[model samples]
Target: MSPVNTSSSLRPSSFLLMGIPGLEATAQHWISIPLCSMYLLALLGNLLLLAVIQSDPSLHEPMYLFLATLAITDLVLSTSTLPQMLAIFWLGPRSISFHSCMAQMFFIHTFSSVESGILVAMALDRYVAICLPLRHSAILKPSTVARMVLLILLRGLVLIPPFALLLWRLPFCGHRVIPHAYCEHMAVVKLACADTTANTMYGLAVALFVVGLDTLCIALSYTMILRAVFGLPSSQERLKALSTCASHCCVILIFYIPGLFSFLTHRFGHNVPHHIHILLATLYLLVPPMLNPIVYGVKTKQIRIRVVRVFCVRVA
Candidate 1:
């Protein structure tokens, strides 16, 4: 229980991050093994996915461009939290400066927002490719996809600062020990001595709005996709169309289900165990990044072949 620095009573100069509730002293070392492994896999998977997509000229389409954006987002999102999480597990509770904490808070939420938007974009890409095949290239041109990715990044950048800013304006007079793995928005805000109604309401609103809108877009896109697939004259055509979407559907489920669960449980699961909540929160970032490339590499033929070619070339 040490402050990184002393400051005015309004806010401490730094906050101590408890690696994980109830496990910090004993089980953390054991926990770090899997955490570190997942982190390394996530890094390797996403980086390799990017390299594969970039090396193959055939993957330079709108769909692959969106996948590349997603790989980058996954890299940023996982990197934002896992390194610090591993450090805390290895080194015990660590003190983070106020600004550093806020910056972490910003990147974590911002890139999460970006990832959500990217998912929606990918869904739309699939929708266009399936439901409007003839116009797909016309609709999702390279320039258009580039602009879409830029806007998605900008949306996250624009929307997520308010979460950190709202917390910043509040006074933190309580103990600055955050009782979780990283500087989660709600976890850090809970230490504020003043009213956090604004933080709570704003955080809830933004989460619901982004998640809701994105979920609706994905659902609608898939609904149309399903209808179009079924309308195909041949059973083989239907299966072929569905096969193309299977990987994306898997990615969406992994990305959103755990994410929404962790988010809601953090806000409303009053009786849930703290360790479970923290683990879910931590994994919500790690699991998808680790799985995304594997899912795509297995499900997409082009990526699989290129991945083999890349490794074969290196081995030779």
Candidate 2:
């Protein structure tokens, strides 16, 4: 070996991120145009929502506060990956430092977990408002809302560290190319040369235990809300209560359905085309942030009015 060594393996210090597999260079540029547009819409919409909530004193209730928290989470979630993704697509800086890649993965997953928790909090808020209307204000005061936000933040903070650390410890000696746009937890871990059993199992555990539990709780809350809504004496009252939850239900479906599909396909559908997986992952990341604000703006009458008034004032 000392005389004529031909097979020495060296771990790459950096990773090349393929923004989307099977897309040509020109096609990537075309895709970037739409991707950048979505990023702008997400930022503008979330910021506008925040500004409206802040300026309006009447929206100082728990529901609006939770919405504000959701806006902030969506803002972070989109920002966490879009710029780097755009760089990979628009320019050609496809290389990410190992540590930087790890950081990106951490932020992406942490904010995602936070968003899921915020949705659950919103469900609980709606349940209180509809199921226990008389005690809604007493039960969900500003202090309680603040605590809920803190707990949501803590939930992400606690759950993501171990995942990140596990990935960090794995020795990645193979090709340092990520096949997707962003540094998704599983995507990065799959590049490791070491035994990935722990990483795989822990990731599955987080998805099943954390997100699964959140989904279950949200379902229970909504079921109870439905029962209460049905028990209302007047059909109009039931409709009003159900209307309050419409936007939330839409947001929940948008956030979870694509994500679940992407997760399942990533794990099981080895025969699925590479581009399909990448596209689904991209949609999972981009769609919710871009759509949540629109859903709320169109569904919530007060927000719609405020948005219209703001536009009118600006035009005038």
TM-score of each: 0.96, 0.94
Candidate 1: residue 51 Cα off by (Å): 1.0
TM-score of 2: 0.94
Alpha carbon lDDT of each predicted model: 0.90, 0.86
Candidate 1 ranges with C-alpha deviation above 4 Å: 1-8
lDDT of 2 by residue, 1-316 (tens): 3311211233466788888888846588998899899999999999999999999998899988999999998888889888888998887648888778878888888888899999999999999988788999999999999998999899888888888777656666566888989888888888877788998888889889778999999999999999989998999998988899999999999999988987888789899898778877887878899999999999999899999999999999
| Residue 249 Cα positional deviation in candidate 2, in Å, after optimal superposition | 0.5
Candidate 2 wrong stretches, greater than 4 Å: 1-11
